[model samples]
Structure formats: C-alpha cells, structure tokens
Target: MYKLQLKPADKMPKYKQIVQSFIADIERGVLKDGAQLPTITELSGEYDLARDTVEKAYRELRERGFLTSVQGKGYYVQAHGDTKLKILLVFNKLSSYKKLIYYAFIEALGDQATVDLQIHHYNAHLFQEIIERSLGKYNYYVVMPHFTLATSQEEYLKVLELIPAEELVLLDKDIPELNRQVPGVFQDFNRDIGGALDALAKELERYPRMTMILPSDDNYPVEIDRGFRQFCRYNDKQVAVKDNATDEVLTPGTAYVVVRETDLVELVKKVRQTSYLLGREIGIITFNETPLKELLNMTVITTDFEQMGRTAAQLILEKKRIKVKNPFYTIRRGSL
Candidate 1:
C-alpha cells in the first residue's frame, strides 16, 4: 500500500504534495514496476482529496513515464528512470499569462526529465545581480530581458556578455549586439501588431479617422508603430504620430493609442476625464493590454505570456536532446 500523505499546514500546494509523495513512493520501490495503482476515484475516496488533485498527480506521473494507464482500467507504475535536468526561469513582473506559461512549461518538461527548477524575479538592480550569480548555479539560463526606459541597453549588454549564449535562452525582448552563443525565443511583435491592426481596421469601418496613441520609450512602442503603419498603408489610412497627448492632433476619426509605461496611463486618464479628448469619435487600441484598455473599452493586442514561458522552457529542453537551436516567437491575441 502507498502512503498517500497530505499536509494541511505546508505552504506547498496540495497538488504538488501529491506529486512529491508519488515520486518518493516510486523511487523507494515500495510501488514495484508495473504495479497497478488505485483509480483516481478510489484514491480520492481513500485520501479524502478532490478528484482533480489525484488526476493532476497521475497525469504528471504519466507525462514523466513513471506510470501508464490501460484502457478501461487504472494506472500502473512504470520502470524507474533517470531524473530530469535543472533549468532556471527568469522573468520581470509576473503576470497572468506569464503564470500560465510557467505552468505549461512544467507540464511539457515532464517530471522524469526535469529534476530541478528555479524561478528568479528580476526587479531593478536585482535582475543584474541574479544574472551574475546564476552563471555557475544553473545548467540552463532562460532569460526574459524586459527593459524599461530606465534600464540602459549597454548595461544589459554587459550582463549578457557574461553568459555563454549557447546555454542562455532569451524570452520576449531582444538584446542588440548579442553574441551568437545565446539562444533566444523572442516575442514576435511584428506579426502581432499586424494582426491587431487588421482587427482594428475591421472596427474602424464603423468608426473612421483612426488615430493611434502609442506611449513611447526605448523603441518598445516603435515596433508596434511599424505594424500599425504597415497595416494602415495596406488599407490606405494615414497616421498622425506624436510622443505625448499635448501634441496629439486628433481629428474626426478613430484614434489608435500606443503608450509607454511612462505617463501613458496618466495621459489616457486625462484624455478620458477631459471632455475635449473624449469628445472625438476616436477608436482606441493599445499595444500592450492594461487597465486602461478594459476601463476605456479599447481594443488590445497582447502576448500569450504563459505560452511564451512554456515554449521557452520546451525550447531549452529540446535543445538538450537535438543540440539544435529551437526558434521562439509570440502569439497575438486581440480583444476589446
């Protein structure tokens, strides 16, 4: 019999507890190879756990090849195998999509193949410090280079120079003049902005005179501008560009708003609150989704953060097997 234990007070999540217990049991050989285990329903009844908990744990074990299920039957233990490798997940400012990506990544890595993992949050000077310390601690370094206007690209490049590019994985943004050794799975905004524009164009037919209000800083808003311009050219629309709202030349048309993290939101709040700004029949769209998008009821082009994380992790693991660079890109989701 397997000792299915549950700790109510532990900070570790319940599903993870079930996973750790199952792995320990398998390694101890108490659960012999090809041994038939209890059905999820049976386990749930025995342990007083929800069925979802048991199912998730079993699915994890199956992904790692620790167990296999027979049709119309229960799961059985598979032969013990070598443990998984260690991989580090580094990011700045965790979001919903990013969390999703991390979960999916763990799923794809499989329990057997991934023995260890570390998550480091990059905040201000902490990002640089973590990168410097990570060189020797982790076998694989997956980085999300999310630079704000305050972060100097030169300073960032100095840190990038330290990691062997081959062992490093870049997620979301790109580092210019990067050495070839770094393998990057970057977020593709070109396609995303194009798609957002297409969606906006369809919306624009109802609301003419489209105006794009993009917040600017460190070329982040520029790529989105390129896409919006490309689509506008494709559809025969003219764009009036400006760095801030004070210079905004809003005519009778739908306004496409692009903003940077700096002062973009405040500008929008001013525009919304001020009767003069909101009086125009302007259709709005943002490059990155924000509270303003939801509050103002504007269209949004966003990156599938969780998917990006998962794919980056998968690419890193895949690189280990094939020794070939697995490409990275972004998924564009358009919404109101």
Candidate 2:
C-alpha cells in the first residue's frame, strides 16, 4: 500500500503527480533501496491511467535516480533527487519595486535556488534583439512590459509569442489582449490608486485641488488616471483631467499627476515655469518613480519598483504552486 493519491484537478500534469508520489515515498523511507516497484503496465492498470502516463512517471523517476530500470526487469526504488529551480527577472528600470522585488526574491528563494535579473530599457527593437540573444540562459523569465505604447508598438507581445508561454510571468502590465497565452502577476493600478488616494487624503490641508496630467496616448498611464479620477469623483471632489491632444486643461490647481515624465516633460516644465512666474508652488506626482522625479521636490505617489522586480522573480519561481489565474500586488510609496 503506497498510499499515494493523485488529483486530476491539480494544474501540474498527471505524470508529474505520479512521479512526485514515488519521490515522496522514497524520501519517507517507505520505498527502500533496491525495492522492486510495479512495472509501468501494472501501475497503469492499477491506477486506471494511461500507459504513457505511468511510463512517463517511471521515466522521470529513473532520470532523477529515484528509480532504476533494467531492460527486461521491473523498476526499483533508489534515492530522492534534487529539485533546484532558477529564475530570471527582466525589467526596464531598477526602481523601487524592482529593487524590492530583487531582494525579496533572493530572500524567499534562499540558497536552494538562483535568481538572475536583466535590466532592459523600454525599447521595442532592443527587446526583440534581446529575445533572440538570450535563448536558453535561464529556466524562466519574469518580464515587465513597460514599453511606451505611444510608439504604437507591440514588440513585447511578439517576444511573448516567440517565447514559450509557460516560461514567462508578466509583472506590472498585462499582455493578455495580445493573446500570448502567458500567466501574469499584475500590478493592480486600481488597488494602488486607492492606497495612493488614502495617503493623499492625509495631506488634505497641504493641497487644495488635485489634477491628473495623463499621457495623451499610453494605456498604463491612462488607466492610472482613470482610477485616480474615479477615486476623486467617489469622494465628491471635482475630477480635473487633461484631454488627449488638447492643451486646454494644463491650468494649475494644487497637484499635477503624470504617468511618464518623458511624454509630458515640456508640460511639467511649463507648469513649473508658470508657477515660478506666478510665485505659486504646485505639487507633482508621476509613475515609474525614476531618478529624475526624485531630483525635484514633487510629492510622489509611486510603486516600490525594486520590490516589484524581486517579487516578480519570487512569483515566477513559485508560480506552479499558485492557485489563482491572475494574481496582482500593489505597493504604495510617498504622496502627492
């Protein structure tokens, strides 16, 4: 009586289940060295599973040295095998979420597994090149698709299609619409906005009116603006947003929120200039939390980009054990 059970509902394949069961028995000392194990056909019949499934289980056990098979003889138990794992964290920036994710990933993985991170900027053509260059350097990729959609490019989506779907764990963005068929760990903008708003509310006396300056043509920034506007509207605060391709809404209030500084630098600079011209101070907040934003005294509502990187690595390594289809995490830092 091996007492091993398999559940078909589990996401891991049936063969892997059978293989793990044998390994567990071996590790528990129930299956001793040189103990004659049932033949693949016999196990197949007993479990009412396909013969190929049973053979795959035995083959994996043999490959891992947990079992030995002689050409004409039945399988025999041997030893437990090492189950080391490896992961790769790929991101556009080495920001807070990225740093936090890196450290947390290393800590969570501990000494058993190794994690390697690659910093890739938001360049579609460069990403396409990197995809071809790093064909088999690691077991899995934790990708952050931070390419500026303003370029009307989906190179990352193409890269996703080129890579094995199961080998990727997308973070901070979604490519599901691309139909790449990969799993994801989303950075919940809605949840993040709620947290940022709560933090902003604490500074109610410091700022009077809040206005969002969104990128005229970016999905991520647009989503954040929508969430922020919804939050303000929910609280009965007047929602002031910059219309796409329109310069009519750049008027000063109290706060100016942006997604990407690169897209709206001129506008931000203009606002600052106008403020200086009028001798008034305006608070600013932007996404991605880059060093340029830090150089200024703008109140920031940002994600922990470093932690995001590290956690992306952790999630990819632990992906097999996750029960949820689309898991998300949001971390709040500073205020505006």
Candidate 3:
C-alpha cells in the first residue's frame, strides 16, 4: 500500500525517499513478507509520481532483495529488513581501558550496529558542542561524562538534559544529581576501592604502614583518596598520601598502593635494586589491571571493563532505562 506522500520539498531525492520509507516499514514489521505492494500505476496515479520514478524505486527495492515482482499481480514484499542501529558513542578521554571497552562494545553489537565514536577531551565547551552537533543524527547517544573542570554540577547536568532522556545512556561516571532520569553503567570509585582494601585486611597485616601514590591530576578521582582514608581510619592502620612516587621514601615494612603505571614501573625498578623482597618485605597493590601487572604477579583493584562494555551494548540493544553498577574486584596476586 502507498504510505508516503510526494514531499517535493524534502531534501532527500524522490526515489531515495521511496526506498527509505519501505525499508523503515520492513524493519518495523509494518510491511511483512509476501505482502502485496500497490501497483506502480496505482501509486503513480494516486501519489502524483512519475511512472519512471515509481518503477525505479521498485527496481532498487528488488535489487536489495526487499521486493519481488509478479508478472500480473504487481510487487510483493521479499525478505524483511533487519533493524540496524546507528549509535553515537562519546567519551571524555582515551585511556588504557578505552581499547577494552571499545573492542567489547563492537564485538557484542556485531552486525546490528554502526557506532560512531567521539571524544570531547573533558572540555565543557567541546562536550556541549559535540552533543549539539550530533543531535537528531543518531538513534542513541552513549556518553561518558567525566569532566575535569571546576564547573558547577548544574552546568554539566544542564548539558546532559539537552539529550532526549530515552535516547541517552551514561557510562563510567555516575551523577547522582540526574535523579535517575536516564540509565547508566558506572563505577562506584569510593565504595569499590574502600571495599577492596577491607576485603584484603588480613593480607595487609604483613605491612604495618601503608602509603598511597595519588598524583595531583584532576583526572584522578578524589573519591579514591576518600575511600583509602576511610578504610585506614576504620582499620586503625597507619597511612600516608603523596603526590609523587618517583623519589618516594619506600619504608622497609610499608606497603604501597600505586596508581599510575609510570609510578608502578619506577617503584618496581627501585625495589628490584634494593634488599627488600617483592612480596615479603614490601607489598604492592595497583589500581588497574594490565598484562605486565599480571606477569609480575601484582595485586590490583579494578573494575570489569570488558563486562562494562558488554553491559552498555546490551542496554543500547534492549533500549533499557535502568541503572547498573559494573562489577569491581581485587585480583589477589603474589605482590600483595
């Protein structure tokens, strides 16, 4: 049946319009397989289409295996068009976890989606610009709203409100101010780090003093420091915090909670050149997991990055509007 009007003002070309409309109907199941389409003559007459225009549209549909022609009866629907999602995946920065999240996301989506990945580099102005320019261009907007600027929370929330609530999904960082208006898969940095330390309390007894290498980078979450301090206070353990670890004073009986990979390398190199054994005299616990850390048998507290990506992809596919806390765990290895 004829479903689209002859909108001459539409920027889309006439034949393309006809092609797209049918494809949309097929994907939506409004047009079913074996269903008969109106005769080209009938469509042309009723919709004011040139005979060549209708014929060309039908030919394109048939070439795409979406239509079949009967010599006497006219055209009928062939195979149904699969629903293909066009998603805009936005992130703040490309860190080590980016690759894992990206690969897992695409692998889960498979042939059902076209993901357009973009980064706003944590600039508030750039973030707003990207969202504005991409408006109405994607079926879904998946974003990681991690900002480093001292801008008020209201500013960020206002920017997010620009996106339609139903079409938006958040990743990585969760904003409690949103009041559950949208769905997200995020990490509880404070609770996660604190809980990990509490879980390893017995193992930590080997070292009476503990120090955290927390660089003064805006990107490094402040919640991590809070969590560490909270855990130490509750456990009655001696604790210290330093901004740099390159020349850190490594005490003989103290354990270290290292944050940066660069810092970890420096500390490990420093330890290897000393008398303290790796797991006995001195202990190491890193923030995130890596192959090198695994090889060195270092304990780590990390979020399930691959699983986070898969969960985000599932949310997009199902168009779900529920919040999920990604799993976080401590991988106990020889270093601890």
Candidate 4:
C-alpha cells in the first residue's frame, strides 16, 4: 500500500499533504509510472479521512498533470510526475534583501517545484524579451515587476497578458499600470512606511529634522515616496528627500531615513568619520531588516521578506488565487 504521510501537527491542509506525499513518492520511484492510486473509498475508510478530502487530492493530482484517470480502471501515475511543475522567477534585481525573499521561497517549496531565476536588471525591454522566449515552458510565472523604464503600464500588461492568469504570481511591488486579477504576495508601501513612521514618531521627536535618502534606481518602490511625504505632512515635521546618492553628509541634529543598503553604508561611513553618534546625535532608519542591521542595533521599517516569499510559495502549492499583504512593522533598535 502507498502510505500518505499526513501529520496532524503539520499546518498544511490534509488534502495537500496527501497530494504532496504522492508527488514525493513518485519522485522517489516508490510509485512507478502507470501505478494505480488507492480509491477514494479505500483511503477514506482505512485512514479515517473524509471521502471529499481523498477525492480533492486525487482531483488536484489530475489537474496538476501528475495523474491520469481511466474510464474503467483507477487513477494511474503520469510518468512518475517528473514533468509536473516548473516555476520561473522573474526579478528586477537580486539585492541582499531580495535574496532573503528568494531563499525563503525556494526553501519553502522543497522538491515540489523546479525554479528558474532570471534577472531583468530593471530593464523593461529585457524583461519582456525573457518572458517572450520562455512562454509555454513553465507551469507558473512569478514576476517582480519593478522597471525603471518609461514603458507604459499597457506595455507591461501586453507582455504579461500572454501568460494565463492561473499561472501568474506577482511579487514585491505592484505595477500600478498592470492591475490584473493575478494572485501574489505584495507589500503595501504606503501603509507599511506610514505605519512604521507613526510607531517611531516618538523617537523621531528627538531629531528636529528628518531626511529621506531615495535613489534614482527603480529597485525602490515609488509608493514609498508618497508614504514618506504623507507621514511628514501628517506629523508637520521638517523633512527632506536626498535624491542624490553623492549627498551622504551625516547631520548631527537631523535623522536620516535611507532605503538602499549602499546609502546606509555611506551614512555609517560618515558616522565613523566624525564624532556623531547613532540613535542620538544622528538618527538612522533603514529599510528592510537584516542580520547585520539588527546586530548594529539599527532601527528599521520594513515588511517581512521571509513571509513574502513563503506566502508566494504557498499560493503556488495550493493553486490559490489570493493577494496576501505581507506583515509590516518596525524593529525599534538604538539607531532610531
């Protein structure tokens, strides 16, 4: 008998656990090609599972191209499920923070998916070309659409329209232009940054002036700009946007809100150059939490990148179509 490894302690649904067990067994060659799966009645009665649960697993197995149902005979394995699922990870760029999202995504999937990572380098043309050549080759298309080009929303949509909605998963920032019905795990930059700043407003009261360091690159979300401005207006505080990367002077009485790690390094360098102290003389707020940032006792306002990737993976595994807003918060360390 083929045993379905279903653990009550596991958070995954029972039907998915059953489906994953069959896929794992097929990969391990325990369930050979053309091997018959136990009937719903048999699994239900023997394993104390509901008939609907077993049926749902078998139904998904067939839908995912892992099994074939014969008219008279039972469901048979389809070529051991070796060609079942392949995913494409279309990212704008692989930064230190995004690597966390990527690793968490791959780790959560385990052997359930084969992923191909492609870097678009914030080029819309190249992003389109990569998608064009890889069409019909993957089971799912996971895209991080953060392009710096003047490419219209229609252009991105035109390219993405080629992929079926069932196989599309948007990640990170949402293209305000291509608001399709695709499911994904995304960050609400406006709400995220606004709320984080609100939580740190008391700490921010120490510094009379707050400056935001925004890079010209498309890697950072545009919504963040709107959020920062909104927060400043609401709080009626003195704030400045340092759009140029070359401007890295650490003001003693002013706090700096930096986005990119490169800018953070520059500010830290300035901090070391002079006697300006962090969290007190020079307040520092960086985006995205990292191991090193925490060790430095730096405050950060960011979303959970691990949850972003894991939720995206879960969407693919369960074939669910839902937009999940990743949890956002602040880690109030000494930097703030």
Candidate 5:
C-alpha cells in the first residue's frame, strides 16, 4: 500500500491532490512503472475521503494513460510520467488581445495538456516552414493564419495539406477555399462590423459625415471595407473611405474610424492639437480593444477574444470538427 497525504486547507480537492501526488511520485521514480496502486476503497479510507472521490481520481488517471485497470485484478501504472497531451499553438503575432486569447486557452486546458506556442509574425514563408516542421510532432495543431492579400488560397491549401484536417483547428479568419473541410473558430468580420455600426446608428446621426481610414500597407480583412460600405449605403450617410489619413483634412462634425494603433495615435494627437473635444466636435472609433484604448476613452469594435479561446479549447478537447463563429460587440466610451 502507498502512503497518501491529504491537506484539508488546500484549494484542490483531496482526490485531485492524490492524483497530483501520485503523478509526482511516479515522476520521481518512487512509483515505478507497472507498480500496483492501492485499491479505491483502501485509498479512500487512508485519505479519509469518499470512495467515489478515490474512484473518480483513479478513473481520470486511467483515462489520461497514467494507469491501466486489469479486469478482476487491480489498477497498475501504465506510464511513469508521460501523461500530458501535447498541443502545438501557432499565432500570427503576440498582441495584447492575442495574449488574452492565449492565456484563456491555457487556463481552459488546465494541466492536462502542454501547449507549445509559436508565432510566425504573418510571414508566409515562415508559416509554411513552421507548419511543415511541426507535422506529426503534436497531438493537435491550432493555427492562426493571418495571410496577406497577396497569398492565394491555393498556396494556403497546399501548406495546410501537410497536416491532417482532423488534427487542425483554424483560428480567427476563415478561408472560403477551405470551406467546411476544416474545423475552425472564426470571426464573421462583415457581420460584426455591420452590426456594430447599426448599434451606433443613433450616435452616428449626431455627425454629418464618417470617414474610415484604412491603411493600404496593413492586411486588414476585406470584409471590414465591405461592411463599412454596406452600413453607409444602407443608412444613406455621407462617408469617405481612404487608404490613409495623411492627405485627408479632419473636419468638425465628422467621425473617424481608424484601424491601426499608430493611426489612432496620430488622430488623437491631431484632435488634441486642435483642441477638439473628444466625442463632441469629432468622434473616434478604433478596431480591437486594448488597455491603452480604455485610458483614451475610445469606443471600439471588437470580438470576444477570451471567449474565442475558451470555445476553441473546448472544441479541441471534445474533438468536435465544427466551425464556430465567435461573438463580437461594440464597446462605447467617450470617443463615441
């Protein structure tokens, strides 16, 4: 029989603590492979825990490949310490919002799985190389492909061919070429922008014109432009869509929608230099929320990144091969 200790003050349940202690002992060579474990009833009595709690812990250990049960016999250790699920997480870049997603994903997975996170920085060549190198190396591959406008769908499909579709979980943007073939958690960009604009329709009426500054160099989703146009046309509002704000003049009674952070900074600087009262003489709406944006009191259009992470983790854990459209909402601050 193995000696087990339970701490009543510990936040972890007695059964889970037993599981962790057993795993730790096994890793330390105290519990050798093929070693027999105490019976559930015996462990329950030893730890002063319920029989069901010990049984549940044993069942979890067996399911995680830490132990094996022999019919009409007893439970034995199947693995010394290799019981963690290996996951490969790939991202475009690590931004504040993406950090939220990554942390949420890690929290949702708990200690049952180990994740190796890598960033390709939106480089197509690096993306291809990383995916090819990671083939067959992980149990699951979660990819966030921020493909540029220049990259063709065929190029993406060819690179994705390296991984089995069942083992892949695409994140953020959705590719029409992949269609329903690959499982993913994607944002409905067009719907999100359009809905956000509609929600702010009453506030937008306060201004005579709205201008959307879209940088040509940035790889913003095309749906954003389409959604902006759709909202402007549908509402019969005068709107100007420009590639950059460099040449445009900032006029009072006009709202500016900026995408990139640098552009937001420039616009804010311009507003302050001219002494335009924010949310009154001129309005600002930025894409994606961050802590700094909150300090500026800027309204933002954003998707629930943490929820996206939790949903993605759940899908991977459940092995569900389905596409989920993440939720999006508008945060109203002093800017709007």
Candidate 6:
C-alpha cells in the first residue's frame, strides 16, 4: 500500500495530494510500470478519505493516461510524469505579424507545452472541420476566427460550441455574439485606428487628400473602415477609399493608407515610376509593423502582437477567464 501524509490546513484537496504522491513515486522509480495501485476503498480507508474522493483521483489519473484499469482486477501504472500539455493553435493565415505572436507564445510556454498550429484560410468549413477534429485531443485550444463577410454569427458560434469554453481562448478579434463568455486577447480595431490617426494629426496636415486602399476580398474587420471614415469626417480631411491600386493614380500632397503588403508594393512601384519622391511628396501608412517595413521607411499602425501572445500564455498558465484588449500604437518612420 502507498502511504501519503495529508495536511488538513493545506489548500490542496486530500485526493489531489494522493494523486501527486503517486506521480512523484512513479517518476522517482519507487513505482514502476504495471505496479498495482491500492483499490479506491483501500486507499480511502488508509488515508481517511471518502471513497468518492479516492475514486475521483483515480479517474483523473486514468483520464490523463497515467494509469490503466483492468476489468475485475485493479488499476495499474501505465506511464510516469511524461504528459506534455497539448495546445491547438488555429489562425486565419500565417502572416509575419502572426509569426511574431507564435514565436512569442512558444518562448513564453518554454518546454512545458507543445503547440500544433493550423490555418483555416478564412474558410468557415475548414474552421469547423479543424475545431471538430480537435475537440478532445488538445488540452487547450487557441483560435483566431477570421470568418468571411458571408459567414454568419450563428455559424461561428455553432462550431465554437464544440470546444469547452473553459479550455478555449479567443485570439485577435472578439466577436459580439460571444460577449464576455470566454477569455480572449484581442485588438480594438476601431479604437486603434482612430488613435493612430489622432497621433498623426499634425503629420496628416501635409497631405490635402488621404486615400485608404482596403481590399474587399480579405475579411478585414469592419471597424477599420468605420474608424478611418469617422476620423476623416470628424477632422474634415478629404479621404477616398479604394478596393485596389490597379487604376489609382499617385498624386502629390496625397497620403495612401494600405492594408495589404501586395498593395503597398504596388503603391511603392507606382510612386517610384512617378516623379514624386517617397515619404516627402507621397505619404504612406501601412497596417502592421515588420522589420522590412522599417527598412522601406513605411510608417505603420500596429498592435503589440508579442505582448498579446505573452498575455494569452499567462491567461492559460494562470487559468484566468477574462477578456483583455492588447496595446496598439503608431510607428512613424518618415513614411507619413
């Protein structure tokens, strides 16, 4: 029989102490593979614990794959302390900014957890399939739901219900339907964009006209467009919104706000083709920061992705269920 000393004053429950003792013994070689563990009644009587308490501990151990139950016999040790926390990380797509968040999460988690990342590519079907297949496999599920404009809130919430709310964390954008039910680390898109424009108020005066190149295909949050429009209207700044840059002409004293890197490249090529010098005659403000953007002298409005990842990891480690709005700022590099 295994002996465990339980403290009545201790915060941990008696059953948990027993479970930890078993694990410690297994890891220290005091308990070996196929070692028989005392029955629930025996353990309960020996430790002065309720039979249900001992049974609960044994159930948890078996569920965690540390022990196996033999029919009409007894429970035996199956494995030691080799269980690694498995996390399922689902993203819309693998972008540079997201890569920053991913690496930061890995660094924060260290070797105690393992992450399996998957991209749904903004497809609702794929997202559903991934979530359904990952229901019970992962101990934790971190999801970035970048649903399309056509995807309904019902569709998203339906699939999201597949995972237990306590074991899930929403990432990047927070949906209104879910409210504050689950913990999330999200960017306040509207406030961030509005704040960035406010920070660049003096610089924006150099350009008489401000144009934003927002792609219609990508499922960008509607808050971005709303924020941009509200800022321009409130400040009385002339603003034009474009879906693409194929036919748009670059003009002096005009600033271009680009969302996609491909559009930024197209705009830069057009500016280079023209006689207007970069940053001086044609101002550019791109969303999301990267090292290459710094080299290109592109001013950016971005959120602290690293900090978001760190906060998410902390929430998971501490088992906190709260919504957090990550920090955002404007990085001016002479582009605007």
User: What TM-score would each prediction reach against the true structure?
Assistant: 0.54, 0.52, 0.76, 0.73, 0.74, 0.77
Compared with the true structure, model 6 gives a TM-score of 0.77
> RMSD to the native, candidate 2?
9.6
Q: Candidate 4 lDDT, tens digit per residue, 63-119?
A: 988899998888899864364468899988888778989999999999888899999
Better of 1 and 2 by TM-score: 1
Q: Which candidate has the highest TM-score of all?
A: 6
Q: Give lDDT tens digits, candidate 1, residues 1-336.
A: 566756677687777888776666566444678889888988888888899988888898899888999998878989675334556677665655566667777777777344233344444367677765554434566777766656666777777677766567777766557755456656556666676567555555654455555546433535666776777777777666666665554444545555553444554555666454342454455555556556655456666655665666667766742222223222222321
lDDT per residue (tens digit) for residues 1-336 in model 2: 454557666788999988877775565355667888987777778788899988888888888888887778878888654344556667777755567667876786777666667776777777677765554444567777787655454556777676666767777776556664666656667667766766666553355566676655444445676688777776666667764313534444465566656534655566655533211345565665556656654455666555554555556656652312223332233334
Q: Mind sharing the TM-score for model 4?
A: 0.73
Q: What is candidate 3's lDDT per residue for 1-336, written digit by digit as tens? A: 557634567687788878877775665455778889988889888888899998999999999999999888789988555557778899888888987998899999999888999998877788898987676556788999888747667767888998888788999888888854788899988999999998899899888888898887746778889999898888777999888788786777788999988889889998988999988888899988999999989999999999999999999888788889999999999987
Preferred candidate (TM-score higher): 2 or 6: 6
Name the candidate that leads on lDDT.
6
lDDT of each: 0.62, 0.62, 0.84, 0.83, 0.83, 0.85
For every candidate structure, what is the RMSD over all alpha carbons to the true structure, in angstroms?
14.6, 9.6, 6.3, 12.1, 13.0, 9.3
Decreasing TM-score order of the candidates: 6, 3, 5, 4, 1, 2
How many clashes does each candidate structure show, in the order listed? 25, 19, 0, 0, 0, 0
Off by over 4 Å in 4: 1-83, 175-179
* Candidate 2, lDDT over the whole model: 0.62
Query: Could you tell me which 10 consecutive residues in candidate 1 have the lowest summed lDDT?
Result: 322-331
Write one digit per residue (lDDT tens) for candidate 6, span 10-118: 6888778777777755654456789899998888887678998899889989987779999999999986555556789999999888999999998998887889999
lDDT of 5 by residue, 40-65 (tens): 87887776789989988898888778
